[model samples]
Target: MPLTRVALLKGKSRAYRKAILDGVYKAMREAFDVPEGDLFMLIDEYKPSNFLYGETYLGIERDDDLVIIQITANNTRTTEKKKALYAKIVELLGEDPGIKPENIFINLVEVQKENWSFGNGIAQYG
Candidate 1:
């Protein structure tokens, strides 16, 4: 399972935000083979003053539409799959919310399966 966090500057419409969440989940399912009903995600809206970023970092030329995505998941994917996941996410989001690929920033944090405890104080994947 992947716990996804999407961060963006505030004031976007509800549909836009939901589209982002949906696009991310769809990308994970397609690229990572995530099971149905395994969705877990959240969005963080930041004020413009607090959501600071380099507008032209690495010459990508990001703007106010920049989206920051971070996902924490088990370290069970190959490098190729990881690359596919990023590409798929950008493709999906670009299609839906019309987010520019250059504005999408993704970070994946991998961990051992034993690191999670879904409930009842037990590591379900341990």
Candidate 2:
């Protein structure tokens, strides 16, 4: 299973958020060959005061778009997946929303199978 967490500075429209999610899911599916059922994506909206860039809070007086994406996966294929997914995210956002690549920050975390659970008391890969 692969878990993807995305955090963005507040103020984007709902359509923009949906575009981001759709782009991410498509990239994950293509890069990792992950089934839709094994993928999870979450979006976190933060207030201007909740995130900082240098001496200014994001989404306040600037157009700097701040995005942080974290991906956690169990397999070694995550390395390639991360690279492809990150690039795809940048491309999608840039083409769809006109967001620059420099404005995005993505993080990847690889974990063991024991670190995740699905439902009904069952682990993701168990």
Candidate 3:
């Protein structure tokens, strides 16, 4: 399972936020091959003043609606899989929240599977 963190500007409606989460989860299932019950995610909304980012980073114009998604998962996926995941996320999110692909930024942090612990103070994956 992967832990997803979605960082975006505050003030979006509940439905809108849910759409974002749903879209990401769908993408993960399709591209990352995540199991049916493995869903785990969090949304961090920040005030405009605190949510800082470049408007034209890497020559890609971004706006207030920018979304920064970071996912922490096991380092078992190949580069091709990573690319597919990114594309699927952008596509799914675009269909739902209508977020521009340019504004959808994603980062993946892969670690060993042994680092995970489902609960009970047990390193289940280990």
| Root-mean-square deviation (CA) per prediction | 0.6, 4.0, 0.7
Quantify all predictions' global Cα lDDT against the true fold.
0.96, 0.74, 0.94
Tens-digit lDDT string for candidate 3 (11-36): 99999899999999999999998999
Ranking by lDDT: 1, 3, 2
Q: What's the true lDDT of residue 101 in model 3?
A: 95
Q: Say which prediction, candidate 1 or candidate 3, comes out ahead on lDDT.
A: 1
Clashes of 2: 0
lDDT of 1 by residue, 13-123 (tens): 999999999999999999998999899999999999999999988889999999999999999999999999999999999999999999999999999999998889999
Q: Number of clashes in model 1?
A: 0
Question: Candidate 2: lDDT of 104?
Answer: 69
Candidate 1 lDDT for residue 74: 99
lDDT winner: 1
lDDT of 1 at 17: 99
lDDT of 3: 0.94
Q: Clashes in model 1: which pairs?
A: none
